[model samples]
Structures are given as structure tokens and as C-alpha cells.
Target: MRLFEDNIHIEIPGRSTPSARSPEAEPSLDGKVNSVSRREAVEAFLRLRLFMPERQKRIVATCMNGEERQYFFDKMVEIAATVEGMPVTYQQDGNGDETIAHLHYFLGDCHWYITEKDREGEVEQAFGYAILHGDLINAEYGYIPITELVDTGVGAELDFHFKPTPMAQIKQALEDRYG
Candidate 1:
């Protein structure tokens, strides 16, 4: 599959490998040839983690050497430094139908649909709808410190399969499920 717009290409084995190109034609990171820029590679890696099916990830993993995998992970940390978290006002200016929840954190029967985040404060806070212990009646929109969720031990997990969804839809789904 084509990984970048540049001449550098990686063909999934079983498919034909492109004829040898000049060593000077490929981009190099620490003297190793790479088909894409570090940022693009890292972005692709993140997309793979979030969006690719588990089977697909296994297929891709089989294609990468341990060194290549390590390089991508190391670069991911460096690239993620510049990426911004959810802003405090994220989706707040919009109605429920327009506001989107971009993150999902869950522990047992508790679920947090995180629509916004405040990183400017000393303690990071997330704003969203929270349902605790399946209590739909008490579920409401509010802020919670991110540390609280992180400190919830190993039970809490960020749902990697969650897609950004409108708050209205999420609310309706919860109502339908819990009512």
C-alpha cells in the first residue's frame, strides 16, 4: 500500500515489491530509509491504533520489524507533544445535536462521554455527560478532573473503538438502553 506521496513505497508482501530505487531517493531517519515524514508516519500509526481492526493491525505488525515498530513508537511521543487536547469550549457553543463527544472513558457500569477538556487549569478537567452505576436519572452534564478517572485503578479504560458522536445521539442511545 502507498504510505506517502513521495516516491518511497512499501508493498505488502504477496504483492510485488517495487524495483530497487536509488538509496538517495528515500527519506532517511537516523540513517534508516523511511517512506514518509516522521509526523505522517506517526499520524498513520495513531490511526492504525484507533481505527484499524485488530486483525488488520496484526497483519501490519507482521510486516514491520521490531526496530521499525520501536522507531514509530518513539517518534509518536515526540510528535504528540505538539498535538492539542480538547479545548475547554469544545462543542459548547453548539446545541446537543451539534456538540460531539470525542472521548469515552468507562469503568464497570460507569461511562464518561467527554466532549470538552480544560488543560489550561492546574488540573485538567473534562466536561461531558456521565452515567454512574447505570443511574440514568442522575446522569448529567458536568466537569470532572481527569485525574479522578486515571486514579480509578485498572478498571477504567479509554474506549479505543469509540468514534466522535453527537451528544444528542449518545443521550438517546443511553435512554433507549437504560430505560
Candidate 2:
């Protein structure tokens, strides 16, 4: 197998702070929905469980910073430690289903995800996401599918498949020319 390195940094659009929900003092970044707070923007984004458009259903994007990113990362490490390469899928409502065969990565970052309604015989409706840490001011800022990212990374070590070969073939082909 030929191994290659990818350092594809994505250019995400900056989300300007939207108007506050109520008429009062403008909330600080930390207090806003996009804030690092548990009830902030990150949570809201997680709720919809968006799938990248059909054109790039395999792609996804998430952002966070300050305590939020760190907290998420640390929690990921802990959750990963307990899992034994179980096939898992996360839901917007915090529910997840486990399967016996699949690929994934950990501590992983997603700048964007391209979605695909089907992945081989998996029949999954969605497929990729990119984790990002913008807002240089904050030390932590990212959005990643904890299970997918973590499992993909530890896949081989735990005796399971990482990313699907078909997907990798496409990704590698893109990288060879212009991923």
C-alpha cells in the first residue's frame, strides 16, 4: 500500500455573531449559541446532525474553542479508551447505534465532511465531517464526530478496519491530482 500525507487545511466561512435572541445586553461570545458552553452553538449544531449536500455528503465541519474544544477532546480520549472497536453511529439526540463492522478515527479533526447516502454496503445516509479550531483567540475550538474520528485512528491497533477502501480510493485519487 502506498502511504501519503495530507495537510489539507479548509477555508471555512467565518460566522459573524448573530443578533441576540432577546432585546437586552448583547451576549458575549462565551454566552452565545456558538459559545463553548454545553448549551451553546456547538450543541445546536450537533442537534441537527446535518449531512453534507449530496454532492459532498461525505464531508462535514465543526468548530469550537476555549474550554469547549479541550473539554470535547479530553472526553473523546476517555470514551475511546473504553470502546473496543465497536461500530458506532452518533445521533443528534445523543442516541447511538452500534454495528459490528465499520471504519473510524480518533482525536481526529474535520474541516468539512462530504456526505454520501451509501458507503459500500453500509447504507449509511451520511459519511464525513471536518473538525476545525478557528478563532485564534481561543485555545480550543473544533467539531469532530468523536466515534468516527477516534475509531478511524485506532482502527488497526484495535483490530478493525479504518476508513472504507472505496472512500480512501476516491480520497487518494483526489489527493494524487487535487483532493
Candidate 3:
């Protein structure tokens, strides 16, 4: 995977450098490609999670971040500290379901969630949400299903998926609650 930070490209295994005109690329100085910062990438990623349906976001995230859930939470803490000016503290809530998983973040009395609705193949769906003061503030919701583990010449692989949420809705919610 190739990650671009400020037009500097860092290539990961199995990822190639995209051409300047690639959809994921942006022309930078002398035809170099620029990419968003890690914080920006993380924010975009979290925002996108709200729109995914059920386990779709879970699958995509598994693919991108591998099986270590801590990586995802670590990034969230980074965002909370740097962008939200919140402490690096969080609490979680979920039902004890393997096929369906919910990762919740309680920050500053607000709740945020990235959830997978189907893990054992009952259904496939995933989403992200935020609530403040007992009111639903922002959400990204979508549904897609992956019935089985994918094998890419390695061991069993988990699926992580996500979709884009409305920026205006999220922005307004944050401004009202945190501003």
C-alpha cells in the first residue's frame, strides 16, 4: 500500500505507486503525488465509517488495519488528543455478540461507535455514530455482507468496510456540542 504524506510517497508491501492521474492521487510539485496527513486520513476514515452497512465497515477495516483492533483505537485516541483537544481516555459498550461487534467510544460525555452488525453471518451491516447529551448527533450508516473469511494465500482474513457520511451533518453536530 502506498501512503502519501504531503506529496511524499511511502510504499507498503503489495501497494504500488499510483500515477499522478490516479483517482487516489493528486498532482503535486513536479508531478509528485500528495496525500493527506495521518490525522486527516484518520478523521476521514472515521467519518466514512458512519455510512457503511453492518459488517461491511468491519471487513474493510480488518483488511486495512489487520486483526489488531488496538491500532484502530490508538488512532482514535490520537484524533481525540490532537484534533478534539480531548483527553486520551475512552469507555466502551456493546452486547456480547461475536458475529456482530460494536466498538464504542465515550469521550467527554459523548458517545461514538463503530459497529459491525454481522460477524457470524446472521446479517451483514456496519455503521458509525456519535451522540451527545442523549441526542443523536451524527451518523454514517450502510449495509453490506461478507459471509466467509477471505484467503489471500495467507491465513484467514477479516473484512473491514466503510462508507462516507454527510460532512454537513457531522460538522453541525460537532459545532453545536463542542463549540
The lDDT of model 2 is 0.30
| Residue-level lDDT tens digits of model 2 in 25-109 | 2344465422233344334334323211221111212222221243443333332332323323332212211112133322222
Q: Who wins the TM-score comparison?
A: 1
| Candidate 3 residue-wise lDDT, 21-97, digit = tens | 33334444465644444355456457544333335445545633432233444444443333232111122123222
Report the C-alpha lDDT of model 1 over 61-101, residue by residue, as the tens digit: 54332324444444434323322344465547556666878
**Per-prediction TM-score:** 0.54, 0.19, 0.21
Please provide the root mean square deviation of candidate 3 (C-alpha atoms, Å).
15.3
lDDT of each: 0.58, 0.30, 0.38
Candidate 1 wrong stretches, greater than 4 Å? 1-85, 90-94, 120-123
By lDDT, is 1 or 2 better?
1
Lowest lDDT 10-residue stretch of candidate 3? 83-92
By lDDT, is 1 or 3 better?
1
The best candidate by lDDT is 1
